[model samples]
Target chain A: MDSSKVKVVTCIAPVNIAVIKYWGKSDENLIIPINDSLSGTLSMDFMCAKTTIIASPELQENTFWLNGKEQSFNNKRLTNCLQEVKRLASKSLPHLNWKFSIKSENNFPTAAGLASSAAGYACLVSALAKLYEIEDNVSFIARMGSGSACRSMYGGWVLWCKGSSPDGRDSIAKQIAPASHWPEMRVLILVVNDERKKYSSTDAMKRSVETSELLKYRANQIVPKMTKACIEAIQKKDFEIFAEITMKESNSIHAICQDTYPPCVYLNDTSHTVANAVHAYNEFKSSNKVAYTYDAGPNAVLYLLDSSVDEFMSVINYLFPPQDTAEYYKGLPLSSNQLSQDLKMALNIPVQEPGCLKYIIHTKIGEGPKILTDPQQHLL
Target chain B: MDSSKVKVVTCIAPVNIAVIKYWGKSDENLIIPINDSLSGTLSMDFMCAKTTIIASPELQENTFWLNGKEQSFNNKRLTNCLQEVKRLASKSLPHLNWKFSIKSENNFPTAAGLASSAAGYACLVSALAKLYEIEDNVSFIARMGSGSACRSMYGGWVLWCKGSSPDGRDSIAKQIAPASHWPEMRVLILVVNDERKKYSSTDAMKRSVETSELLKYRANQIVPKMTKACIEAIQKKDFEIFAEITMKESNSIHAICQDTYPPCVYLNDTSHTVANAVHAYNEFKSSNKVAYTYDAGPNAVLYLLDSSVDEFMSVINYLFPPQDTAEYYKGLPLSSNQLSQDLKMALNIPVQEPGCLKYIIHTKIGEGPKILTDPQQHLL
Candidate 1:
């Protein structure tokens, strides 16, 4: 290979929201979680992180640009990811001894509490792996950048095993089911309007590991059974079981957040109102029609079947009326419908003021990261 | 005694906020708690429930009035409390057969989330017992009315023991320390302004008992040690340990609420902001100068020594400034002091918009029920 030759790779990766949330780390350096967690990889057609990597001997040094702005390469996690990827690449590709330039951006609002970092890192690692001709799994290398990034490497349902090995070689994400297995599944992301400073997940989870005893108990006792049940639910296509487990696990994870010393409060008033609305909706249906899960912020991620989408969207509109209904929903189209008086009575939650949720994203389970063979998609 | 002769008694009772919370019930009917709890009784001068009880043969039937409004006597807990008080009185005197009338009112805002019911029940029971000339402990009678009411029947530090027996006869509030034991201790109740419908504590705790596994774990494993540590801290006047335990227990109880299926959300955004401010204030001081405990509402009850009051008040005013500073504080007066530049910089929380808090009440440890001798003080 010519030493001065430039190689470029571009990829888009999905964002995964954990049903059985990953909180504390058993090993901070290796990004080994204290508990097994599972998540649904969202469709990249609606939301994704796109990245391009350029490697050339002509480049001066390694540099990173996030969302059109230059960010320092001096970050510990960023440096670790680059070094690990290079180490794995140098074993087979001698021409990999070159400076790299990376550019990444999220299609959706980065400040909306979506797991942009997970998708961003997953995309970067996938693109880098392809550039160096490393065909093996790069999820572990993504895990070094962001713990949840490992789960984003797979499609459909992914489970991150909390392996016992100290070296963390066995602690990798595995695909529980492909997106095709649950084609009826749909997701609605309710982006809450908040202006408060967000608590950093890295710092929050670190404190939880050091201080929260409930988190420890949850890791040791509760999550193993929950992860198994979730897997079974997904395999059997049991929406009711999946919904209950999803909501309960979400609450349990937030319970651990609250139990942490000084307590990390992620769910705000609007988040609570959204949760109450979900419970009320389920109670009205007399069955599990929809499930809600919150990550490290107030935004709510709802899981439901395609059959329930029209009715549930009506209910969501009735309870939390948007300021501009035309611009309220993004991604997949939703049919507008009127809510019945019985449902209005059943979901007795007071109608929230207009625009409690900034907007909602309609998407579904989707494939893993995709390499863009067209040079037109490249960022640099 | 003449059958038409009327006997009247008027009494005032303090409100107690638990440092270690009592969440679930072992015996729902008997009102026996699943775990022990500790609290501090706020001074009656600032906030209390005054009740007047009258007994006479001329009365046609039993009746109750709360806050000058006629309330139905068919309420289960109220009827149970009345019947129990009569049974105890009948054992000592036959004149107790006369019909009884009760009137009660709280000085503070009923909708502000202060423990008004606790104070109301305690005052009613105390006044009723005096009218019937029953001198024995009436705290157990108050417990029949409300779980936390038992704690309000004592002054200063109070502990409600979660008795092991099925009968709940041993489940009673004991005075851990009197008001004079720690005169320097002060309380500031920050009433958060909210328009949302409040979750009923009775329903919330019942669901928590049935659905929350963490509540069971916390009741059985956590409260005992916490109660002991809090008592030791109070006895030694160790404000640091006391503050740490108070804040942790508050967070733990809220954690159990979140862990409940469907999850009960009691703390609002303003409530969370107040908690963050408390933590930030402590972090700035490099010591635990203040502690905050929230009941089942948005209101925050803070505990601190008198020496730290001026500095902490300045911090609170800076973070959550009032719309009208002149009308911001109620009860005891606070010395207005400017926040130092260093302290403000150290407490790096963003200043909140004006009037996040409806008002603040400054009070201290005070005696329990007080019998008023003057006829002018009677509610009737």
Candidate 2:
């Protein structure tokens, strides 16, 4: 390694929300999910995690910084991912011997069940692969960091197939479509509460595997059917099937979480309210205009078409009117259209306190990680 | 039809918290659960539903009054339960014809998942059965009104067995013991939110039965094992077994609720906090000193020994100190003792807003429905 010429790479990866959630682990050490899950990558331009890696011979040891704060590199997942990437690199760059320094930051709050870890780990693996000149798909490498991270490595529609092998090399995410394939699709993120989840997903998953019989049934029966249906729905471009499955899968994941020993309740009153509003809205129109899904936190991620965004936004506004404060809504501005009277009556949307919903993020499907050629964007 | 001699009966039924929850319905109209469930009724002195019924030929129609408002008696379940009692009475009073007036009120808010329906329906059946001079077990009659209401027909340990009979004749609540059987056991109800649950149990149960595969598995497989274990735990007076099962069962019901189509999120942040506090407390003590179970609403009913009540109360106050407002902490007053340093550190209980938990009700197991000897307690 050249002492003066530090090999550096910076990349940004978008967060992915599982329509069919990945819960439980077959091999915790390898981050192999018990069931296959499907997800859609959010726009990298809006919500994402950015990671930068610099390899220099002058560096004494590996160090990591997350969200501008120095964190321990002692995390097994992160170390394992780096080791995998380094192993891949050694095949080509045998002479490369440099200490690594990694810095990662997410646009959204971490541990809010926003899949920040997925974005973080995916960005890390991608940046590291670029730095090491590794040409292979890094989805498997990201899997070693976080199960969902593998899915985050791809954009648009993606599926992480739960493969049966002695090892998890086969459990890599495959992209179902590119952003161009679904140009009309849009995502509206309702940030209910950005507070760190009371229960860690790691702990919840471990407990569920150990104590919940329902988790076993879900992993074995429900998810397989869900995965098949979701893929088909996406392929056929059937919004109704896609939306129903998305909502059901979200509920299934949360249900198993509740089934876990001690139970995990990620969705709160506001989350339920959002889901109800979406269902009521769709029912009112007698068509699936929008679909809502929630992860391990209270925040809701909704999928809809570009054409329905304004009317749906109006529904959201009418149900959860913005507070007097300027920061009531954060994402894309709602369209000027007013909500239809029939839809309003169907939703029976209640007037919620402004603070109940923290803010909203407006974005759409986007490509996977991209290299930041501009040095100014480097986190270092 | 003795118009001048109006028969009056008044009874109080204690609230019950299911250790093994009843979630799904085989027949919604019959009020028959898909699985057997177990419960421990709270002390009537602390929390209960008081119902007064007057059978008079002067009355034009059957009527019901809940809390202070006159509710509709047109409810089919209520009508079915009354008809069952009347049919049993016809054997003796063949010519007796009288319309009944019922006034029911819960010590706590109804529809808050406090088992108000259980207590209300149980009280109703018991009162009507007495007036009709029916000596048979009225638990089955109550079951016709609410599946869990059957469990409320008993005190201390109770089990609502889901029978194989299609007619629901065999489905009835069986009391395992009286309150005196577990004198040391105490219940502390942490009312997380008194507001009515957004999703009613009836609606959620219907949805779960229709859409949740996990619920099907749970009813057919998981619940039988749970029912056996809970009964054995109660019989053995094993707090550890009872506590663990209670927590797991509550989680399972909520899980199925989440698994239900569109999902129902009953537990809130405050509910999670209380459960966390309980778990941390138990782990700290190296024994199961307390167990927490939540219903379809956010309230938490904790089961613990009488000896642990003072210490736990101290911990609760320390964790959730009431605000300056007078109404913050309503139920039982805590002991003067401060929480132990070790316990506080172990719980790591977060400081919560005053209104997050409405109040706390201190009670224990009590006897089944008891007729009020004093007419002064009657509302009408």
> True contacts preserved, each candidate?
0.81, 0.96
lDDT of 1 at A316: 85
Best by DockQ: 1
Docking model 1 quality class: medium
**What docking tier does model 2 reach?**
medium
lDDT of each: 0.89, 0.83
How many steric overlaps are in each model, in order? 0, 0
Tens-place lDDT digits, model 2, residues B214-266:
88898899889888988888888998998998888888887887777767777
Off by over 4 Å in 1: A1-4, A57-60, A86-92, A324-328, B1-4, B90-92, B324-328
- Residue B117, model 2: Cα distance from true site in angstroms: 3.3
